[model samples]
Target: MILQDFIAINEKGIYCLYGDFYLDPKEPVATAVISHAHADHAVSGNRDVYCTEATSAFMQLRYGKNAALTFHILGWQQQINIGGVEVSFLPAGHMLGSAMVLMVYQGVRYLYTGDFKLQPDATCEPIQFCQADVLITESTFADPNTAHPDAGLEIKKLADIDINIMLGAYGLGKSQRLIQLINQHVPDKTILVPHKIWPLNAIYEKFGYQLGNYQIYSRKLMKEQRQFVYIVPPFTFDSYIRATGVKRLFASGWKNLQVNDKDTLYISDHADWNDILKAIEQVSPKEAWTLHGDGNALKQHFDGKLPVKIMN
Candidate 1:
């Protein structure tokens, strides 16, 4: 088994390390293993793609029939072998098709955290931790000061507000979490979703989450609003929320986002500072490397604890 520290953003491939081989210059790799259906990781132009069924369908719609070279629908706890690399997909707690891969190549296990969250998002499965020989984890929300507060309390406060509550989040992970929260807490009323976000709601439904009767944003419905809570993407707030007579609120990892009379919920799609540590500790990895948000900060916390690579 051999390992190297070289992650490069190649023009030939979406993102890859230097030594690793890529298939096509235009559509590199006959088989590409994807973690989720987020536009960033699951780019168009790949031939044969190996991702979850949820992501494969999403790719088909966005990239056409030939978007994926092939399909390898990997579910949770399922393991497959690819050229001596024993790969297993685990729940990442990010979205419907999100997964964290644990690969064992020549007896050395490498865990890759492809955007995971530990706190139970209202809409998805809780994050799963596994032991590995080496761990490569995401640090999207690695800073301790940026840790989120109790979601249950914040949501209750928002729902109790005087005006209609509209939470601004992305269409993927954040939207589902909000829908789950609203469904669990306020299942009595009709939940409304912007048309663009309807696609994601369908994916969540495939995962067996019951989000109750969701409809498109309509003027008629807004006029009849009685303490209704609407979940939407951030762009929808600017384009539609104001017209609907709903007060705007934001839920994202970014700090100090601009908003008026709006409360910001610090929910994130990646593991927090403590969760990151616990993930590595649980694995008891022989070596560790960090990528994504504030990796060095996460590395500093694990000093003298494990062999870690922060960046360079």
Candidate 2:
């Protein structure tokens, strides 16, 4: 069997080998399979791309009509035969339309997990046990020693405060999650967002996520409400939310980074150490290959347990 990573970063854009596999280095790949709608994972380019219908709609807002048909809309668990390779989409639980690619050929199966969380989330389907001879998972928060508080409890602790609470998270799945958690718990106050993330909010809205009464911050809005919840990108702290008197709370898998003075909470879209171990055990491959992260760490954890190989 032969394996290779076709994705590489360059000056202009990414050279994609699989997702939007295209020939011309100057143009986007001719056939791309998007994992999700995140800008980092899915971006518009000059060619045919394939993704879930929800993802195509999200791309349409970004690239206009050009993104709609350029994509082959697939549903979750749908199987397709591309060339001689067999591929299927599985729920990754990162966000709406997020997927893990399962490829089978020559009697071996490979599952490429694109930012998945095992816990049931608001935005997408629950993560399930997938059978793959080779599993490729992310290590965004791979440390075994790191632990996070219960999501519900931690969210309540922040919202219980009587001050204006601005939660720092990514505009995609994280922000919507915060909104849902806060609104259901602390219904009196409204949810909020940064100005730029409003469009992403609209995209979420298209999928029937009803986020009510969220607006970008303003002195007028602040003066009226003594207590509210605001969701903004973590980078917004540097410029937008730094000056405000509001209390800051950061949510990410990497609370260990100590990047902010605000209260830190570890909530992530990737599997924790235990999740990784369990996934590996469940797959129980005769030979295991790890990639898209530090392979040695995963190896060390599974040491003496399985046949492991380092994969790029």
**Model 2: per-residue lDDT, tens digit, 65-135?**
66534667788888886655677788777887788877776676777677777766776666655777767
In the range 50-114, model 1's lDDT, one tens digit per residue, is 67777787777667866766777888878887655667788788876788877766576777777
Total colliding residue pairs, candidate 1: 6
- Where model 1 places Cα greater than 4 Å from the true spot, the runs are 5-28, 187-190, 240-245, 258-262
Residue pair clashes in candidate 1: 23-29, 24-28, 47-68, 47-69, 48-69, 48-70
Global lDDT of each model?
Answer: 0.68, 0.67
RMSD of 2: 3.6
Error of 2 at 292 (Å): 3.5
Q: Highest lDDT, which number?
A: 1
- lDDT at residue 121 of model 1 (Cα atoms): 69
